[model samples]
Each structure stands twice: as C-alpha cells, then as structure tokens.
Target: MRSLKNAFAAALLLCSAMASAHRFHAGITDISFNARTGNTEIVHTYMAHDVEALLANLYGRQFDLTDPDDQDVLRKYVEGRFWIGGQDKARLPLRWVGMTADPEKVTVFQEIEQTPLWKAGAIHDNVLIDFIPDQVNTVNLNEGNAVRTLTFDRNQLEQPTR
Candidate 1:
C-alpha cells in the first residue's frame, strides 16, 4: 500500500512539473472576405496568459487588456508585426475593429473596406514570434467554400496569398 502511494505521489509530481513548463506558443488568424459587406475581415486569437506575460515583460508592468490604452499598445505591436499587402506590394489599409479578451484568450478584429481577398498579394504574420522563439502562427484564408491554411514560424514569416 505504501509503495503504491509513493508511486502515485511521484506521478502527480511529474504531471505538475510538466504542466508548469511552457508547452507551446501559438496563435491563430483568420482572414476572409465578407461578400455582404464588401469588406475583408481579419481575426486574430492568442492565448491570454501568453499575451499578458509578453506585455508585462515588454512594458515592465501588468496590463489590463480591457483598458483602451493597453489595447492600443497591443494593437500597435500587432500592426507592426502583421499585415496584408496589395498586388502593388503596398499594405492594405487595415482598420482596427477592436479586441475582446477573457482569461483564456484574446481576440482582435480588423478589416479592409471594399477590398477582395483575391487582391491580397502577400501576408505577413509574426505576432509574438519575436518574443517567443518557439511561437507559431497559423493563418486561415476563407473563400467561397474553401479554406487555405498558412503557417508562420521562425523559418517562414511571409507567404503569398495566391
């Protein structure tokens, strides 16, 4: 009975340690054209805890994502890191549609008015990758009944939308 108890305790300890270790850093972004609105919409989702940690490390303070100032800071960081280019290689005018956050995740919304998804020449997404070496961002492009996935990692940051 004592041996079994010890073994159980050891297993619990190992599980706890594994949980404490950072397992993965990842983000998801979805880009789609809204036919009804004639707009190109973009949504990005990231782990809330990871974003909080990143903000704390960068600004040396805890950030309340609910605050406009804090959200703007994150927005600026994101804008600098991620963007979609037009066929002319110029960045599309992406308007920030704001963000929502919960304890588990943060979701950001953006849009390009009157632009079609097919007009997008390239995509650049490196959000959190600069801070987290192991970060990976997956972008899903949704068109009429079709979905294409592009992955951004340390090795690949930009990809053609075509």
Candidate 2:
C-alpha cells in the first residue's frame, strides 16, 4: 500500500512537470499601412518560451533571446519566413526594425519601406510552422479603416490581405 501511494505521487509529479513544459503554439501579427509615411508597419508577437524552444530545436542549441547574436539569428529567421506580395506578385521588402521581449511574449517590429499602391496584397506568415506543426498565426491587416484578419497554420501558408 505504501508503494502504491509513492507511485501515485511520482505520477502526479511527472504530469505536473509535463504540463509546465507544454508550449502553446500561437502568434499574432498586426500589419498596418501608414499613408503619411508611405510605409507598412508589422508587429509580430509570440510567446517567448515557445520561440526559444523552436529556435533551440532548429539551431541545435539553446538561444538566450536577450543576447545580440541570438536576436540577430531570430531576426533573420523571421525575415525569411514572413513576407508580403504586391499586386505584381513581387515580394515586398521587409526590414527588421527591432524587437521587444517581455516575460510572457516577444514582439518584433518590421516595416515595408516602399508601399505598394494596391488595394489588396498577399501575406505569407509561417512564423513557427517549420518547427511546430500545430502552430497557428493570426494576421491582422489594417488598410485604411477596414481591418481583415486571417489565420495561418500548416495547411494554409498565405492569405490575401483584402
């Protein structure tokens, strides 16, 4: 009977640890066009722990996000994964501005300097889908007064920002 109680306690501890280590696969991206600046702003937010784990798995080493080298790697990764296409189907250039990391989330700021003079465009956001199969990224495109939202996962890679 004592052995049974000890086994139950061990099982409970194992479950608790697993729960604590589990990562939520989700991110949010807000895209807005500024007529005054003639540029498009992008703010991408993700859970810091999830991003760290994903980068660790990809690079075969743990990344300290606060480190400049680690941040450069992350910035490069994001630049390649996320994109916007203009009316001619040409990819819009995304320039990484900076990033902010809180305890819970990491937010990246980017901008498309040459604004596309189109009513609609295509947005490709594959943030963590390469490392996380169950990853879900929600993108909000704000064009003038209208806001359009699209959710991307493993199945859907890009969506029209119309």
C-alpha local distance difference test of each model: 0.96, 0.85
Error of 2 at 92 (Å): 0.5
How close is every model to the real structure, measured as TM-score?
Answer: 0.91, 0.84
Give per-residue CA lDDT, model 1, range 29-140, as digits (tens): 9999999999999999999989999999999999999999999999999999999999999999999999999998999999999999999999999899988999999999
Question: What lDDT score is found at residue 143 in candidate 1?
Answer: 91
Q: How close is candidate 1 to the true structure, as a TM-score?
A: 0.91
Candidate 2's residue-wise lDDT over 15-115, tens digit each?
99989775568999988887888878889999988888888888899877788888999999998899888866778878888998877899999988867
Candidate 1: residue pairs that collide: none
Q: After superposition, which runs of candidate 1 have C-alpha atoms over 4 Å from their true positions?
A: 1-18
In order, how many clashes per candidate? 0, 0
